[model samples]
Target: MNFQQRKNKILAQLASRGEVDTRELAMALDTSEITIRRDLNRLSDEGQLYRTHGGAIPVDQPPLPFEFTQKATANQSAKDNICRQAAALINDGDIIFMDCGSTVFRLCQFIKNRKIKVITNSMPVIQALQNTAVSLNIIGGEYDAARQAIHGSMAIEHIARYQAHKAFIGADGLSAKGLFAHSEKEADMALALAHHSHITYLLCDAAKINKPSYLHFAPLETVQTIITDAALGQLSYCKKKGVKVITV
Candidate 1:
């Protein structure tokens, strides 16, 4: 079959199965793995799909676009406490770089009409701050439907112009090994925020502590502080690394 036909077949298979492996593609197309890999790369670059380490998956799915209310309900008390403390770290009018995550969303909820400017990639954060008196700027970029955050050329271009006193990030996983995220785009964006802001704070629940997700964002030494529950069981590691650990 020709290249276009092969790509179409691969996309169809991915759409039907939600995910497909390189080996599977080779078998289905009667082609070599290298050729299939090239097709996957091309399709991914064309915004036709997303390629994982071993295989490919649907691009526009749950994580690329997230639901705020469902996520907000998962860990109510932890999220709330984290938010209140996160808000405390901020001066009344400090400009902040807040990323998408239920925890950061909780922080946005805690500040009641506070005088602050929030620059974020989450649609939920934008919605939360828009009703309140907090000044907000929503970075427009490629919207990843699964994570519900925008990251790409547009988001980076807008974020580059602003310097924030503090940046709050929510990570998918963390450990003595390093800080990691599920998406390479998100990992890159988080690193950009850490470099852009004066201080970068990572807000994670105990559930994420010491876990290594598929993608690595940055190292623990790169982060200024890590805010989590005292029960996360990795406080010792954080302390040893000179990472200020905050427990609520």
Candidate 2:
């Protein structure tokens, strides 16, 4: 097929599957991987799609802050898989910081039976574990009604006052520049938690691997490990910066 024909096919795949990987697209089109990469790059530059670690996702408007209830059900399966892996990393009597992201909230289900202390700003997470044996500490801050979470200078100060064995946070997108969030306050809260914890874990689904967001919260080195449902080519870049990845 001609160059334009190849590019069109890539776009069609992204539209149908929401994402297109370089290797997979090359094999499907009977083209070299290098040619596929070039097509993806061109498409990205033209704003036709958003380039990811090993693939590209359909192009759309910039992301906005999503409501907790809305996001909790958006990618339930991937979030569940990621949460299961995160819960296995927890042990009895451990203290952890859980962010307000939906993926982090899913961890509550697996960890409810464990004897662990959780420090969080997420109202949903608090509600999820309210009947469990786990100890909970809610951060004090100005509440964000849209996000159903707490954030502000008060929340950041509260996070810094305590240290945890681990901190599990979520991101809207992950690129070579680092983790991205939709809101500055949310990013601030995540950064504070990562700083005060012994180990920071970024819990994200495959859809978030190469997405873009307005706020660049922290570099990949800010977190000690990344927990996800798919392999990310960018993991190599993160490894060189001393960040480990756990793909479930």
Predicted structure with the largest TM-score when compared to the true one? 2
Q: Residue 144 error for model 1, in Å?
A: 2.2
lDDT tens digits, residue span 30-115, model 1: 99999999999998899887766556656663222225556655666676677778888888878889887768766865664688
In terms of lDDT, model 2 sits at: 0.83
After superposition of all CA atoms, the RMSD between model 1 and the true structure is: 14.5
lDDT values, one for every candidate: 0.78, 0.83
Worst ten-residue run, lDDT, model 2? Answer: 61-70
Residue by residue across 13-57, what tens digits does model 2's lDDT show?
A: 765544566777889999999999988888889989877655665
Give model 1's clash tally.
Answer: 10
After TM-score superposition, the amount by which residue 141's alpha carbon in candidate 1 deviates from its true location, in angstroms, is 1.4
- Quote model 2's TM-score: 0.72
Per-model TM-score, in order, reads 0.70, 0.72
Candidate 1 pairs with clashing backbones = 62-146, 63-146, 63-147, 64-144, 64-145, 64-146, 64-147, 64-148, 65-145, 65-146
